[model samples]
Target: MRKLRELFRLRFEAKLTTRSIAASLGIGNGTVCDYLGRARVAKLTWPLPAELDDDAALTALLFPEDAKAQAERPEPDWARVHAELKKKGVTKLLLWQEYLEAVPGGYQYSRFCERYGRWLATSSVTLRQEHRAGEKCFVDFSGDGVRVVDAVTGEVRVAKLFVAVLGASNLTYVEPVFSEDVATWVGCHVRAFEYFGGVSEVVVPDNLKAGVTRAHRYEPDLNPTYADLARHYGFAILPARPRRC
Candidate 1:
C-alpha cells in the first residue's frame, strides 16, 4: 500500500513520468500504472510512509482475484547424495530411485538425471582441469597451410601460418608469418594476448623450433624469447613431448 502511495506521489507531486519512475525502480511502466490504479481504487491518501507497505497487504491488493499461492520447492541435499554415489560403483539411476523413495515428492527421473549431471559437473574433478574464465590459452599451427603467390616476385608464401586458440572461450587469433623464428613467434604471442584482452596463466604449445630449443622425450628447453614472453605475461609454457607414430 505504501509503495503504491509512493508511486502515486512520484507520479503526481514529484511530476515524474511513469516510464522514468519504473526505470529507476527496475520495473515495467505498466506495473507502476497498475499500482497507481490499485491505490486510487482503495481510496489511499498521499505521503504514506515506508513501514505501512507490508508485502502481504500489497500482494492482497495487487492480486485480489487470485487464490492459489505460489509453490515453494524444497532445496536438494547434494553433499549427502554425492557422498552416497561415490561409494562402491553406485550409478545415478540407483541414486535417483533412492531419492524418489526417500522424499515424499521429489523430482521425476528426467529432471533428477539432469540435476544430478549438473551437480556432478560442479563437484567432480576430472583428468583435464576445468578451464576457468580467462585462465589459460593454447596455441598451435594448423596441420594444413594455405599458399598464396606473390604477384611481383613470383614467390609462393603460406597465407595461413599459425592459429592461437583460447582454451576457455575457443576464441581464435591467427597471423601469417614467413617463418616460425623466435622473433616472429614471440611477436605472434604478444599480438594474440593483446587480441584476447588479457594474459593467460599458461600457454600449451607443441615442440616447435621457434618456441622449443631442445625437444626431449621428457624435458624440453624453451627458447630465450619464448621464456621472456612468458615472463612478460606472467605465464608458464608446457611443451608436448615428441611422439613416434
Candidate 2:
C-alpha cells in the first residue's frame, strides 16, 4: 500500500520517471510501472481519495481478481454436486457447464473439480492412523475394478485388486485376483508378507466378506481360515470398524 501510494506520488506529484521511482523505492522498474499503470487506469491520483486510503480499498482498486470473482460468481451447491456425481452418465465436465450457466464467470472446469476435490477431502470421513516402524500392515481392496484382457481371444474380465502397505514405510503390494473370496484373500496376505520379508505385530484389514464372516458392532466374527492364517503368521488381526465417519 505504501509502495502504491509512493508510486503515484513519484509519478504525479513529484514528476519523477518510473525508473527513478523504482531506484528510490528499492523496487523493480517494471513493478513501479505496473502500480502506476493500475492507478492511472483506476483514475486515482497522488494522496488518493480520503474515502479509500485503507489497504483493502487500495488493493481492490489496484488488483480486483479475488473480490470480483467472489462477488460475481455464485458458489456451487457442493452437496448437490457430490450426490449428482454418483448417478450414471454424470461427470465433472457436465457439472461445470451447468455451474457456468448459472454464474456466467464462475470457476473454469479444471478449477471447479480442483475445488470440489478439496472440499470432499475436508468433509469426508477418514480413519486417523498412528503407525510405528515395523508395527503394522494395512490392507484393503481398491473400490474400482481393473479389466484383464485375453491375449488372442479378445476377452475382457473385471479383476479385483488387492493392495497392502506397511504402515510405517508404506512399502506397497498390489495384486489382481479373480475374486475377493477367502482363498484369494488369504493368498494375497501370504504374498504380501513374503514381499515384505517379515510380518508386523498386527495386520489391519477392513471388514470385507472374505476376512470377517459376520459383521457386528462389537465382537465381529473373523473368518475361520483368516484366523488360522493369523495364527500361523504370529500376528494379531484387527478389523476396522465399519461405516466409520
Candidate 3:
C-alpha cells in the first residue's frame, strides 16, 4: 500500500514542498524528493491517470529505468573484473562500486555478485579451497635453478627461484636467490609482500628446510627465524604437510 497518489496531490494540487509532503505522509525527506524528481522527469501531472492509480503502475511510469528488462541492462567485463579481483585488497563490493561509477544503474549489488559467480563457474575449473582476498599466500622454491653469470668477475652461480603465489588470485611473485637460507627465505617473503602491496593473513609455505625445521602432519615446526618473521608481519604460518604438496 502506498500514498503515491496523495504524494502527487500534495505536491501539485496542494503546492506542498517535498519536506512538507514527507512530514504529512510520515515518509523520509529523501524519498519524497526522489518521488517528486521522478514525477517531474516523467512529466507526470497532479491528477494521475486512472490506469496509474495502482502504486506499482505509478512507480513503473515514474521510474522507467527500474522497469527496463534485466537482459537490457549493461553487462560487466567478467574477464576484467576477474583479473581485477586477483589484485591484493580487491573485493566484489569495491569492484561493484567502481562498476556503478562507470555504468550507472547497471546492476544491483546482489545481481552483480550472482552474475559474477555464474561467470566464474563457467570460466574455469577452480580449486576447492575458497581463498578470500588477502587471506593466504603460498610460497615455494622451483626445482630447477637458473645459472647466473656475474658481470664483473665472470663467475657462474645457480640462482634458486623463490616463488610466492596468492591463493585467491593466483597472482605470483618470483625472485632469484643463491641459497635457501633463513635470511634468503625471509627476505623473499618480505619482498613478495611489498610486491603484493599488503600481507596476507596466512602464509602457506612448502616445507622448505629454511622455513620449516621439522615437518609433522599435525604440527610442523617452523624455523625460529621464519617464526619471527611471521610474528613481525602478523601472519600465521601454515607449512604444507611433508611430501603432501
Best by TM-score: 2
Tens digit per residue, CA lDDT, model 3, 1-245: 24666677778899998887766766668877877787888888757778886755764687565457444777788889999998877999999999999989888899899768645533443224567989999999986789999999999999999999998899999999998898899999999999999999999998879998888988888899999999999999998877652
**Colliding residue pairs in candidate 2:** none
Overlapping backbone residue pairs in candidate 2 total 0
List the lowest-lDDT window of 10 residues for candidate 3.
119-128
Give me the candidate number with maximum lDDT. 3
lDDT of 3: 0.82
| Candidates in descending lDDT order | 3, 2, 1
Candidate 2 worst ten-residue window by lDDT: 118-127
Q: Which of the two candidates, 1 or 2, achieves a greater TM-score against the reference?
A: 2
**Per-residue C-alpha lDDT of model 2 across residues 117-234, encoded as one tens digit per residue:** 6445334333345679999899989767789999999899999889999988999999998898899999999999899999999998998989998776677899999999999989
- Give the winner by TM-score: 2 or 3: 2
TM-score, one value per model: 0.45, 0.63, 0.47
Comparing 1 with 3 on lDDT, the higher-scoring candidate is: 3
